[model samples]
Target: MQAEGGLRERKKRETRAALAEAALRLALEKGPDHVTVEEIAEAADVSVRTFFNYFPHKEHAILGRNPEHLERALERMRTAPPEESPLTTMWFIVHDVLRDLENEGELSRRGELIMGSPNLLYQLMMASFDDERQLTAALAARMGEPESAVRPALIVSTAGAACRVAMELHKNAPGRPVRELVDEGFQLLAQGIDPAFGPNQSNQKGHS
Candidate 1:
């Protein structure tokens, strides 16, 4: 029974992935405004009803929330030894997410499409803010405080800023790993930002 249940869940995940990929590809080929849920469903070899079951709308298919990713990261933080700082734990979580995204060959293409579309960029940023809220809540839970607590809020916000800097710098640089850029951002934060942003820093690293 457990095996069957697992299989069923796996199939559902597969279907969702298929639909998401198809939706993004179509949005890239045709503008997101031009693509319909039916088209995305058909491309993924699923019925329109199935697509609705997976996602309420076409945008959800393209910009889906990754709750499972957050859950796994939180589980890791919960089990981590107390010696690890919250910043380090947060970096591990962020790095895992970047690694997962980098493994997808279509990530670069998706980034390009998002960059080209202002509306998509807005939607993406809003979704990102939502993710940050969720991350802050998890961090607070780990710290045994309310999500509104200043410490967790500041920590998560700083972490989010570091991630943004890393992602922006690494987005178009095909040769540099996102993790390296992320670590560099964190290092800058640790070493006083003014010194790290000096001209020497720019000359020291190969961007592409």
Candidate 2:
């Protein structure tokens, strides 16, 4: 029964991934406005009912945010070792999220899709804001600080920027290992940026 249950869960994940990929591919090819749920279902070789079972709305399928992935990251953060600083915890969580996204291979096309669709752009922006809010709350709780605390907010912003810039750079240079780029970003955060970039330094001191 356990094996059977595991297989069932695996199939569900596969179906969800198929539907998301089909939705994005169709949206990119024919534009999101023109793509219908039925068409997406057909593209993924699933019934409309099955697509509805996986996603409540078509836009969600296109956006392809996996609840399971987010949950796993949250769980990791919640159970993180006492010695691990919030930033290190965030690094692992972000790496896990990136690994999942990289497996789906959607990050590269996401930029083009968002740029072409105004609605999607707005949806993406709102979704990012919500994600950050959730992470901030989680980090604040973990640190025994209020949500308004500046330390948690600052760390979340810095970590979030690292991941976003890494994704953007990876989208442009597909050959570069995204994890390496992300590491470089985090390293700069850990060991302060170039002195020239410091606010107190001369503006004309350097170019990086």
Candidate 3:
């Protein structure tokens, strides 16, 4: 029973990934406003009803921000080891997505599409803002701090800024793995940026 359940879940994930990839590819080929749900469904070899089963709308597939994934991410962060610092815990969770996106060339194309479409840009911004709030609350509870505390807010926001910079760099130079840059960003962040990079600390390691 457990094996059958696991296989069923895997098949669902595969179908979801196929739909998301098709949606984004079509959105890039046609303008974001021009693509239809039926077209995306056809591209994924699925019915319109199946597309709706995975996503309420076309934009959700294109942006890859479904509620299930978001909730799982927040839960992972919230239940992270007590001994691990928030940044360390976050890196493991986020790096998996970055690595997968980079492998699939998903990040660069999504970045391009989002920048070209005002509607997508605004939607992404609003969604990100909402996600940050939920993540902040989750992290706060894990840390035993009030949700309004500056530290939790800073952790989520700073991690977000680092991801944006990493994506831009990845888009510009596809050869360099995004993880190298993101790792550097987080390392600098873990050191609080000043002490490790102070004028007195002269010796430097070569860039990744």
Decreasing lDDT order of the candidates: 2, 3, 1
How would you order the candidates by TM-score, starting with the best? Answer: 1, 3, 2
What would the TM-scores of all predictions be?
0.81, 0.80, 0.81
Where model 1 places Cα greater than 4 Å from the true spot, the runs are 171-173, 192-208
Off by over 4 Å in 2: 172-175, 193-208
Best-fitting candidate, scored by TM-score: 1
Better of 1 and 2 by TM-score: 1
For candidate 3, the lDDT comes to: 0.82
Clashing residue pairs in candidate 2 are none
Residue-wise C-alpha lDDT for candidate 3, range 1-208, written one tens digit per residue:
9999999989988899899899998998888899999999999999999999998888878886656646777878977878999988778767766766767778778976776688887787788889889988988989999998999889888887787777677777768666887898898889887654554334443332
Off by over 4 Å in 3: 66-68, 103-105, 193-208
Better of 1 and 2 by lDDT: 2
